[model samples]
Target: MKLTTSALTPDRWSGEVLALGVFAGDDVPSGLSWPRGADAPLRDAVARLLAHGSFSGARDELVAGPGLPGRCERLVLFGLGRAQQVTPHTARRAGAAVARTLTSGPNRRVAVALPSWRVPGPDGGGPGGPGLDLVEHLAEGLSLAVHCGRWNVLPDRFRADYGSDLPQEPESVELLGAADTGRMLSRAEAFTHAVVLARELVAAPANLITPQRLAEEAVGLATPGSRLSVEVWDEAECRKQRLTGFCAAAAGGADPARLIRLHYRPAAPVGPPVAVIGLGLTYDDRGVLRSGGAVQGAKKFMAGAGAVLGAATALAAVGGRSEVQLLIPAVAKAAGPGALRVGDLVTTASGATVELNHEDAHGRLMLADALHLAARLGAHRTVGVSALGLPVAAALGPKAAGLWSTDDGLAADLTAAGYQAGELLWRLPLVDEYDDELLAPFANLRAAGPPSGDGATAAAFLRRFAPPGAWAHLEITEPAWSPRIDGYYNAGATGYGTGTLARWLCTR
Candidate 1:
């Protein structure tokens, strides 16, 4: 949808739908300003709607009505809850609610008058000073929600007649009384495009999105004259580089393994390049012996790769001085004659020998090689994103990802970026006590640790390969894919880390 800013007040705005965001309690929010003697009819309509005592202005609550509004066909009043409790996430949810309510109708235009609340402080106590703009977050939510509505319209192999009757989203959206609308909308569009690309990559079937296909998509992101450059390493090149761990993990797959690298360099450099590595298991099938419904979700094994590539796409469009390197080790794990068996010893690029005890634990192997390569490439800081362990998902649930970092400053920066991007992150300790769980009798490390505190142990294992400067690990499983449409998330891949990574890169 096209997004634009309007100088017109609510009374002068004419559209198919005019959405007004109201805060809790009787008083109107201070963010909504009016010119002298203007917006009286709109104010009266809001006051009358509130006076009826039917709407309490609770979060996500909606009350719509017709008539008594100038030139507008419909009026939508969405609740923003308490003023003090509002944040960028609040605006995002409010925007999603408005889009979901009005998109199914014949309305082709919408005007939103939502308050641009301040972000939380460093301590997350309350609204700190002005940092990120709420209008950008609102646009992100609206665009994402509208794009999600059309996700069902994609061609499906199993159901040829699927999503034939789905309604289209509005053609244009105007942000009333918004500042810097063009720049904010441009950034929002970049983020939306990246996130939608990530979702599509994760939602595709394994047969269609193999390692080669993923490499092709990465190459496609680097258009001529762009700041991004793409490179891919084939099986021979990977072996030459001592990427034995990745090669072992992708041993038996029909598709060849690929090491995809994307580099984004600005016109002028600022600091050392930050490296971001993502796990690229296109399809993970535990092993030949494993069976059940668990493998059905194997298609999402590459969610981390999708997120990093998406971030690369966004960063390429939104120019930044910080040089960024994105790495994805695209490989597939399946039941085949060349598959690594239990008790097999695999040597990683870091010269660490690992005892492969579990077939499903191969992601850590690929990540280990990637992390070592990043450090070898002289990156000042490195961040690895993956759905590596279930213990993290069990601890944080679906709303937040687990963060483990060796550098406190990097951790703080990531937390702030995640907050600004509307993605929640909970810091988990990288306890040294769990290091014993990864110890092997004959090898330097064991593939799988004990079930208890496995998340911490897994982080500890990856920490061995972390760069000496600064490094972080983001375990994003539950937050990357959802089973239902909750808030701004659709029923599939949520593209969770793309926004956070993009925000972090640009801000840095």
Candidate 2:
């Protein structure tokens, strides 16, 4: 999309919608007033709201102008919710509200009055300090909201029955101020491009995004200047290596599976390498092979795999000269007689055995193998993306992802990035007491007990295989699968960790 910055005069721009950012009290910019035609209607609305003396200005509203002279069909005014407390998150909501409203109208062009924000700490001053940083974040959220999957074709009957009209593609966006619109657009475009690739990769027909397809996707990333490699192990090869845990999980599904090892070596390696493992279950239909409703807990099942692709996408976008390895154990944890049973015992790639405490816990098994592979590849830090469960949702709510790690330093970096990106993450401890229950007679890892909180217990399970001196990260599952729509993200896959991983890669 084309993005331009100029001394924006609302009347000069004729689009279906125009968005304004309003702050509490007198914080709203006086120089940012709309055109005379746009002003009358807004003034009337403001007067009415003013009538309600209790209105302290913390909410925004969209208004239709009944075809005013130079005003667009609608104007979206966003409330900064107390200028003193106005944050990057408020900017995100403002941007998203603008995009969503514009999408509803036929107007292909839109302009936004960028939200004002406090600059970085001492590194950057407050008000006068890099005020446009919020604009960058707003643009990012808006772009992510408009992203659609090219490959999620509904079944014929479902499409005919429930398909709703979606918004038209926006042709251009206009931002006020002499700020660096070019830089903001560049970053937004790059992020959207990665999201498009990720959505397409995840939305690929289950068959096309299978173990083999995952291998191809990784190989494709390694074409010319990029250093990428894919090591594929078929069923026979997996058996030879005794990746019984992974195999047992895959055995339940009808599709053949493979353990995909993807390596990305930077142009010139810097510090210790970082490794990421993604759970690649192309299609997550739980009832694939099971009998009377055995596969009930597969809701949002494909999210773990999708998060993995997102990690790779983030790595590819922030393509710096740093070494990173990504591993994905692509499989569908379908239940069939051949599948690993709840009480079955299996061995991990680390030579540590694990009893199949829960078949649905298969994501951890693949991660275990991938982590082992990462250590073998000599990675100094590691992280895995998987959807844990609703229990963690109970802890952090839908907007936040649980961040469990062994290293406080890495967690600190990621948590800071999460706040900057308007993504929520809370660091939970990896307690040794939780790992006691996982010990099995023949297995190196086992479910200690019913998960206290999915995020904590799942991270605990992963810690069983974590190598010393390595940092391991677990993404709370709900936020990743959250269907909540903010300004730009419509109610499907949020692509949550892309920004976190990107920031990590870019800054670190």
Candidate 3:
């Protein structure tokens, strides 16, 4: 959706739908000041609803009606709970409610009047201060909620199949606020646009987004005079590069594999480049003779690749000084026919031997090769991306992803980035003892060792390939996607880490 900042009030804004926040009280929210008739539509809607005894404005309470009919079309009332308890997260949810409500029908345009999220505090300024952050994140929530990431659209029968509840996204969004941050809001929309791209890539059918397709898509990122540079190492080059672990994981797939590398170069060279390696498993079919490998959901295995690519895309759009390279092991983890066996031991370009235990844990092997390649590319700082629900996602549930890092500073930075982007991440340990979990009798390590510390052992395995400096392994998972659209993220691929990745890399 096209997003823009405007000073227009809900009363004057002529749009298909208008959304306004209502605090849980009889009095109007004191945050936003307006002249006479500025908030007439909102006030009138609330007054009418109050008369009907259905507008108590409790937290999360939503009231929608044909307020002002033709001129405004519809007005949605969102409860903001208590004013003192309002926060960024609350604002985001409120925005999402607006998006979901607006997109459920035939509305093609929306205007939102968000109350100032600033809470007066004793320190003279609000905790989050007065700026465009509230509006920015609110806009992001809306953009994500109303976005359509589907590659296949049965246009005429869309409603018949998916129902009108699922949205194709409104054509435009108007965020009515006094803050004159048109440029900043535009950048926010650009960032959201990239995130939506990641969601689209992840949500697409696996057959359509094969390793070859992902490679071509990376190449497409390079435009004339753009700072982004793309390179693809085909299966042969991967063999030449001695990426044994990647080769093993990619074995049974008849489709060719690719190690897609993208570099965002700056005019002036800085310190060592930061590298992000994503497990681009386009599809997964496993042979779990070792532990009864029951692999399912092969389609969205490429979620991590979509995230890092989305981050790179957003960073490229909003120019950054630091050099960043994204390494994607664009290959399918095919099952049956020559799939890596349970007892198979593999070596990587880094010469680290890893015993393949669980076929589902094959992702770590690919990440190892990519990390080694990143070191060769002069990246001392590296990040390996994993989709949500790798190992024991139940530990963190749907709210936060797991973060494992060799450096405290990088871990702190990444955690902070996740929080700043409203994507929660809890740091997992990289304990010295966990390193022993992967000590294999046959090889230098095992992709997975004891179940004692499953997540940390995976990170320890990745630590083997990390060059010096700071190395972090991000284990992320998205919320469940539901056929019944629940908020912006239903029961499907949540381009979960794209925003956090962009926030972390762009700021650095």
Candidate order, TM-score descending? 1, 3, 2
134-186: candidate 3 lDDT, tens digit per residue: 66667777766766434332121211255665555778888776458775676
Indicate whether candidate 2 or candidate 3 has the larger lDDT: 3
Q: Give the candidate number with the greatest TM-score.
A: 1
Q: Rate the local accuracy (lDDT) of all candidates.
A: 0.79, 0.61, 0.71
TM-score of 1: 0.91
Candidate 1, number of clashes: 0
Q: What is the TM-score of each candidate against the true structure?
A: 0.91, 0.83, 0.88
> Candidate 1's residue-wise lDDT over 302-412, tens digit each?
889988988888898887787888999998777687888888999988899999876576788899999998988889989999876456766788789999999999999
Model 2 per-residue lDDT tens digits across residues 318-348 = 5655687767788855665586667877677
In model 2, the Cα lDDT at residue 87 comes to 57
Q: Which of the two candidates, 1 or 2, achieves a greater lDDT against the reference?
A: 1
Give the Å shift of residue 130 in candidate 1. 2.5
By lDDT, the best candidate is 1
Q: Give the clash count for each candidate.
A: 0, 6, 10
